[model samples]
Target: MENRLFYVMFCMILLLSLCSSENYFTKNVKGEGVLAKNSYVNHPPNPPIVEGPLVGLTRKAYQYNLTLIDPDNDLLIGYEIDFGDTIEGSSCCPIPSNTTLTLYHMWYNPGVYNVKARTKDGHGLWGNWSTPLTVTIMEGDTVPPVVHMLKPNKGLYLSNKRILPFPMNLVIGGITVEVEAVDEGSDVSRVEFYVQGSLKERDYTTPYSWDWYEKSLGRYVLTVKAYDFVGNQVSDEIIVWKFF
Candidate 1:
């Protein structure tokens, strides 16, 4: 009887040790114990959105906007852009979810091209490429207008008796924002000036400028978008501090 009791105790101890150790059977009841700590099944992001012009010119740079969303609400890290001509470009950086990114590309040969993009999640998983945007490239001058911010050039300035950074421009009271725009293919139609993404003024003549006098004192984003007679457009922007 004593021998039988000893044998039963030994078996129980062995089973307990196996369950307490790193054995798979210890916590693996009903598939709950098999997963590692803080681990879950990863899902890829949804298809991206590609928006741009449908007709372009060969050997001319054109801009396209890309936007994406992750089904799991994960942060985006990078993107893969395919121009459908055996050339691919990739951008890697930490970008917020649902943010739109602008990319530029030039085609060397004239033909029909399909543009597509895919996003990479925080988990390093690449989602599917979006539906291709068909673009037809031909031989012509489709170059966008060239724009430059004349005033508020990147430099240091005084604001409220404090020395600002070298790359920041400080404005006291009111400042005149000016830009220079030129087009090689067609005449410039108009230049639109924007402050904090709001349309402030429109200049239809050369020496494009706008007098910005707002009582609100803070940092503002100044943008100048120039459009040509042929619908080709380009933009230039600057950041300035307003203290008045």
Candidate 2:
């Protein structure tokens, strides 16, 4: 009876030691005294670097090198460039992280423009804009700014080429109208948002966007018109069905 009691006590002590060791390891691995899965946080990319000519001739294409680095080591998919002509340009192609890309642009007229750049990572997060580079154009031409609708259109449905009835985009709640405007010559002055042929709002800055809330649910035509510094204009429209 005495030997059996001793064996039982030894087993109990061993079990307690094992449990204590497990707890210690677990706490060390977690670094917090709790048992939980580690959460991942995505960091945005670093500000982009725009390198090009500080002074060039008008209407002549100048090469600019754009370099971006993601803090989380994510892949960079695109770039947003503000040419300081009041126009912005974007590239939606994926490129490796921490790499330099070359882009070409020309000024339509002679002016001192502050060019800046930013980047978007694969996770759809945008970084801050870089320091501006003042560029002086000698002589230039004139062209209308290019505009396009970006939001409210479901990505898969619109890009897939699947034909639908009246509206190309389907929205269940209030939607935001986002636009991308670019000009090679003159800078964009303003972007106008219209719904069902009526002007709703006008944005005079980069990342032109307007939030639209409609009580009634139905199909509506959304239009975005962009005007350049030279009074040149362009517009793009999209049809959307808003329902519950």
Candidate 3:
């Protein structure tokens, strides 16, 4: 009985010593406990869903709908929009995630514009911009005018050559900008010219041509907005570069 008791005590002491050594190694060498303490996972919100009219009249208020989804179910803060006219707007305050939002805007002038939207999460992280929606504004116009840019070579070269479509070593100094607009419903009222999104000149007669001189050496987006007598409007744009 005595030998058996001594043997049991020795086994217990050995087991206790092994446990203590393992704990010391874990505390000193590893520095952190084996069990996980605090853990967190975060993900950015998904792109917003934007819905609005494709065509509308100028000076008229248009309503748009936006919806956002967060995979992690995080709270959304706010949203913003790019009106494509060099104007940007945003939500008034933070809102709940996975909800729909409605907003309104008006276009004073008639043109083809694009609108984009994005949302922010509660963590102040902004998600990717949503796919753009094209909005065409008209002057209470039902029928869009038919217009095209005339090239130097009438038959051989296509009209309205897009600049930056390909890199060219040659520089362009000045080019004659001309447009031919025809309306089936009514006579062409006027043709307006725009350079880099700003109005430059307008012609009220046929054989519409503008002597656009290169003010500086840079790239420019030339646009023409035309209207008919019955309020029908149309627009066309081209990219050009001026080296000299």
Q: How much lDDT does each candidate structure score?
A: 0.81, 0.78, 0.74
Query: Could you give candidate 2's per-residue lDDT for residues 84-179 as a string of tens digits?
Result: 775565666777778988888877778899998888888889889899999988865457898878786653233223234333576655656778
In candidate 3, what are the lDDT values of residues 1-244, reduced to their tens digit?
Answer: 9999999999999868866553422233558644332335678888888899999887567898888788878888777888777555564566677799887887878999989888888888888998889999987545767988763222212223434434432235555678999987666889999988999889999898787664557766778888887666889887665555
Q: List the residue pairs that clash in candidate 2.
A: 58-139, 85-187, 108-140, 108-141
Give the poorly placed runs of model 2, Cα more than 4 Å off.
1-34, 86-88, 140-244
* All candidates: TM-score: 0.45, 0.43, 0.43
RMSD of each: 15.8, 20.7, 16.9
lDDT of 1 at 61: 72
Residue clash pairs of candidate 3: none
Query: What's model 1's overall lDDT?
Result: 0.81
Which is better, 2 or 3, measured by lDDT?
A: 2
List candidate 3 segments past 4 Å from native. Answer: 1-34, 91-93, 141-244
TM-score of 2: 0.43
Model 1 Cα RMSD, 1 decimal: 15.8
lDDT of 3: 0.74
